[model samples]
Target: MATFEEQLKALESVVERLERGDLPLEEALKLFEQGVGLSDGCKKELEAAEGRVQVLLQNRNGTRRVEDLDLEA
Candidate 1:
């Protein structure tokens, strides 16, 4: 199984390719499908992480705050 990080990296690459706007229609469609799948995978992973953290807060008295992990800044 691809890890969350790997899927995220693939998604970034897919976006970059689309932004370049050089791909043919068929290629673009394939990449678009891949991008969608990767996006969905990333969302699922994030939701799972959030649920785990909520459980942590309830059972372990952990703080729920999250730090920014964005790379765009």
Candidate 2:
């Protein structure tokens, strides 16, 4: 599995490539597909981090309990 930092770097590169605006139609579509995959990867990375933070904050006892993630009324 790619680390969070690695996924972030890949996401950044994808954005840069898209921003360059020089790709031909076929190549641009390919880059767009890759960007979508990278976007999902980034989202998964963030969700994983949020889960870990929840675990640490809640001090779960060998089981995950997510109440710690919500502190608003």
The lDDT per prediction is 0.89, 0.81
For this target, which candidate reaches the highest lDDT against the unseen true structure?
1
lDDT of 2 by residue, 1-73 (tens): 8877887788889789889999898998898898888889889888888977877766536765666445575
Local accuracy of candidate 1 as per-residue lDDT tens digits, 1-73: 7999999999999999999999999999999999999999999999998777666555345557555445697
TM-scores of all predicted structures: 0.79, 0.71
| Distance from true location, Cα of 23 in model 2, Å | 0.7
Query: What TM-score does structure 2 among the candidates reach?
Result: 0.71
Report residue 28 deviation for candidate 1 (angstroms): 0.3
RMSD of each: 4.2, 4.8
> Relative to the unseen true structure, what is the Cα RMSD of model 1?
4.2
